[model samples]
Target: MKSKYKSIIYSIGVLLLTVGVLDKLWWLYICTIYTEFEECRVAYLSLFPERFQNAFLLTVIEILLLAVAAIIFSESKKAIYQKKASKILMIISLILFGWSVFSLM
Candidate 1:
């Protein structure tokens, strides 16, 4: 793939990953808030399937996929400077992963 195309693909992957991470955080926050209220907790869980209730697992999978995509993007880039973007993505992913883990605990 061309450099421009690679960058675009990388950006899209990053965006998707960002949205996924944010969604996980939002759901976690909502669940935490409703923990004291059993009825509200059940209602909220009912809104999503059983699989989706495990936001931590889903977010971890997303982070792994995003990391792979970033590696591919960096490898495809002709310019060395573009590799820096991958570093930024990695840092963001790590922080999000840590946040998700903390929330789970």
Candidate 2:
């Protein structure tokens, strides 16, 4: 793809990321609306317990890993036209990858 298309790809990425992050709020709202349901209460706590939803560092690391994989998928020589993405992704991925590895240590 031409460099011009990179913006579209990034925009879609941002949209998906926003939706993913905001889903928790929506889930909470739903559970509250259905407060009388035993299933809703159980599912809400089991699915979004404090420990799971509050794992910010782990979530960021996972998102970075996914981004690195996406860059590799697009920038691989086989992708040809798709490889037009700026190398900034590669640089960012490298730094984040190192950070994540060190964090896991």
Q: Candidate 1 regions off by >4 Å?
A: 37-60, 69-85, 98-105
What is each predicted model's overall lDDT from 0 to 1?
0.60, 0.52
The digit string of per-residue lDDT tens for model 2 on 1-105 reads 456765575555445444434544555676777857676545655656576644455446456654644465345423453344434444544554565456456
The sequence of per-residue lDDT tens digits that candidate 1 reaches over residues 40-94 is 4555556667877654565566566656555554553434535677666656655
Model 2, which residues run further than 4 Å from truth? Answer: 1-64, 67-84
- Candidate 1 local distance difference test against the native: 0.60
Clashing pairs in 2: 1-81, 1-82
